[model samples]
Target: MEQVTTVGIDLAKRVFALHGADGAGRAVLRRTLRRDQVMEAVAALPPCVIGMEAGSGAHEWARRFRTLGHTPKLMAAKFVAPYRRNGKNDGNDAEAICEAVSRPGMRFVPIKSLEQQALLSLHRVRQGFIAERTGTINRLRGLLTEFGVVLPLRSVIVRRDASKAAEALPGLARRAIDDLLAHLRVLDERIAAYDRELEAQARGCEPAQRLMKIRGVGTLSALAIVATVGDARDFKSGRQFAAWLGLTPRQHSSGGKSRLGHITKRGDAYLRCLLVQGARSVLHTATRHADRMSRWVQGVETRRGYHRALVAIASKNARIAWALLSRNEELRIE
Candidate 1:
């Protein structure tokens, strides 16, 4: 068999499809292997470049392949889609991955370390808990409204006033609200626990600690940024980093004219949301400060409206974060 110069793997829980190509890009091997047999099959081949689509287990597989003395590259699944010429299947997907990996300009997803993945998992779980908590609170408020009992929007107020409000409702409604309020309290405690864990984790991480020094960034935002963007060097500039975070506007240029629309919103929604939330907090008091950043934000709010100004600030913050990480420096406040 011709020396397998490159290999693409279609990963699955039970089965995996692999396509191998020679130096001249000619197919040399196409085979399917059971999950347990995958490493054995790969070990049989001489060291070569291995490509896989970015997914749940992609990073772990990439790390495994690297340990086996092969160069592993994980490409975004969308980037490999254009290479598929036939109906989608494991074989076709593997072949497409093989072709995409050979492209000189194909972008690859960074392989995240276990620690980064762990932090991200925490953030994801915390987000889910927060969402559930919001739903619970909304349900409580809706139920109370049915009985002509309206509480303040703040969660603290809601919690404090819920019991009194429930007393004025029907016995059944009162009991239901009582149960929901209890659940809400539990979720609040869970969310608080997660926040404390994240804060402690951020305090121990040097990059996160540095990120916390930036205005509008707190423990959660700093931890999210550090966990999401492991190596800022992967991005060419702060602008590119911001673009990756989907904070930049989408462009549609044709002929000599250029059309820019809303933010692309292409990357991690959680990270973008955190940055935007931070920006909103900053915008609330930007007019009270005379710093250059605040003044610029104020000017933007005047010209582009408050919402657009918030996005711009978020993008700027993302860029600043990239610079800090890339240069191994802290955020320099002016």
Candidate 2:
């Protein structure tokens, strides 16, 4: 039977380290596998439990392992950190991963699908281009001001008036202005192309369409939620999802009384940032508003102020999103 009951795989770009244990958790197998060798080796052993960290291509491997009759578990890297003994290496990491997977109450990471990773890649790249565009716009505006040519107050105006401003500048400033405009044009084209590609992707997925029903959630939020949560079924409730996003208050407990601190600020920072920004947009742009959630946000804003209000709304939105997704419930703009 070869009797490999538990296995830990330390995954990397090329080579991977493996540690297999018997039913009693005694080390019985230690091996190194090239990327191509991973599947067949595990498949050859009897059905057993397998563990790996949750990052980069982890879900694909998890799916593959399961298909081979293995019970695969994905653990957060932070949860597995306590298992590390001393000097770090693949073998040591594999052992730590194995130990962490055996814990009774440990919360495991949900594996993401290939489509999810692909969509997230598009988002990450688009964000980079957007950031670059912002910097370019700021630089252009500041440089023009130094040359006694000031554009209007708006970003859209600055973009449209660049050529007109350039025409008015003297020779030295004119050439510089033209160079900056060239960069802006390139950035604008790239950003537009990425947006089109993302919109195409969003239309094809039901999860994205569902997410778009929320007040603040737009194309970006819809896509992000769908891609990030490969299986909404894994989350017990919507509040769990909100907590996972670190949208909820931090915990500080002792004795019978429990006090929550500021938000934990854990989990996907980019996702959190997008959700908060979306909340801000909904706060300002929406014309009709009078609901329990909105009223709560209004009250919070009066006491705590704008920044805190923004965070509270973001957290509330996260919770609502989870509820809507997990229950297959529709979003109501309030």
lDDT of 2 by residue, 68-157 (tens): 999999987998889999789999999888888887887888777777888999999989988998888888889888878787667799
What overall lDDT goes with each candidate model? 0.91, 0.84
Please name the candidate that would achieve the greatest lDDT relative to the true structure: 1
- Which portions of model 1 show Cα errors greater than 4 Å? 145-153, 168-172
Candidate 1 on 136-253: residue-level lDDT in tens?
Answer: 9889888888778888789888888999888877899889999998899899899999989998898799998898888888898999888888888988899988888888889999
lDDT of 2: 0.84
TM for every model, in the order presented, reads 0.94, 0.86
- After TM-score superposition, the amount by which residue 152's alpha carbon in candidate 1 deviates from its true location, in angstroms, is 5.5
